[model samples]
Target: MLKTRTGILLLAPAIVLMVALLVLPVGYLIRFSFYLGQTGVQTSGGFTFANYVRLFGDGFYLAILWKTLWVSFVVTVVSAITGYPLAHFMWKAAKRWRAPFTILVLSPLLVSIVISSYGWIVILGNNGVVNQLLQFLGLTTAPVKLMYTNFAIVVGLVHIVTPFMVLSILAALEKIDPLLNEAAATLGANRFRTLWHIILPLALPGIGAGTTIVFCLAISAYVTPAVMGGSGPNFITTLIYHQFVTLFNWPFGATVAAVLLAVALTVVFLYVRVLSRLGAAAPAAR
Candidate 1:
């Protein structure tokens, strides 16, 4: 009984912090969403569903939601495709190769998004490095129009999220028993067959986790989309920013944030369901 009390006492600070940082803000946002903002004063929780009703009526908001979903989905798919190969290489890398390879995977995370966005601006801009290289290689006479495009946004987001995906996948892949593959080989399984049957199945949890992380990260992104996506690839976050900062629509932004949270939670729920199904199937496969 004393030990339980002691543990609770020790955890009290963390619990307080969580409530202060997360709970309070979320509660306030939800509470505020049920009101109207007039002259910086929020009032009138009318006990009505007007805010949510308004959310569905707007076509632009719906477009932004669709775009956000599409962008996150594409980013997650691309990250998984690239991350799996890199993780496979990492698993098979020699001891000397491991350190350098790990550094390469992690190096992008060290650079700030601001710096990388600027770098992308230069690279994708007209008369920038990409155009210069293309021209020098006799590919084109004029600079390509690349900046302020959805493609640019995707490129920037992929670069940012790849390191996280690699780390997660690598951790998952590493835990897979090497002996499992060796045993498969002993049973006349080829390299590809062993990887398909043994390695990929074991790595599904990491894949699920990495996909969820990258999708959520990409969907909620503001900086890269602001810079690279510009007017072309507006997302839920950008719409929220515009509402709160530009339109002074705090209540609207709160509603949008609630929607964003719902979307993220939905994706997480689906991923969890799929992961659970995979977990159930794992034992039968073995």
Candidate 2:
């Protein structure tokens, strides 16, 4: 009873913060999502399902949702692919050398997100560094149109999220017993085989966690997509902003946010389920 009481006390501040900051705002948004109102400004009316009906029933909103999901998925996959090798290298490095590499991996986070987004624009813009290099290399007569596209958005998001994936996987890797690798090697398991059969299985938790964070951050991100993708109603986040800030349609904006939250939750749930199954099967496969 004492231990339980202590734990509750320890958690009190976080619980209160969550209730005050997260739960209350989300609850209000959900309640507002059902209101019937005009699109031009703030509105109040009796509860109605019109917002949801319009969201699902309209093709434009559906397309935006699909695009958001697609971009987020791409960013998550790219981040995982790029992060794993960096993480594995960091894990294998000498302890003395680890700090520099860790700092390098985390360097992106030191910069502001908006600044990072603009930096991408500098590199990817038509008259930017990339185009200048390409032209100097005689690759093309004219500059490539790289900015304000899905490609630019993916690039920016990947840069921002890869650090999280690397750190997560690295944490899991650090928890692993080093002797396990030696045991596998002594048993004549090659590096590739060891990684596939041992390291990957044990590191599954971190990979799942990293991917989840990347996906959620990518989908809900507004600034990167807004700057890199040109803010043309191409993303749900931007759409939500437009409805609430520009059009003053609070009800519609709230509905959009609610839908996004639902979709993110559903994807995370399914991903966790799949990961759990893989974890269960890992021991048998070994």
RMSD of each: 2.1, 2.4
lDDT of each: 0.86, 0.90
Misplaced by over 4 Å in model 1 are: 231-233
* Candidate 1 pairs with clashing backbones: none
Q: What is the TM-score of each candidate against the true structure?
A: 0.92, 0.90
Model 1 weakest 10-residue run by lDDT:
36-45
Q: For residues 157-251, write the lDDT of model 2, one tens digit per residue.
A: 99999789999999999899999999999999999999999899788789888999899988899998889998577899999998888878888
Best candidate, TM-score: 1
Q: Over the stretch 156-186, how does candidate 1's per-residue lDDT look in tens digits?
A: 9999999889888888988987788889999
lDDT for 105 in candidate 2 is: 90
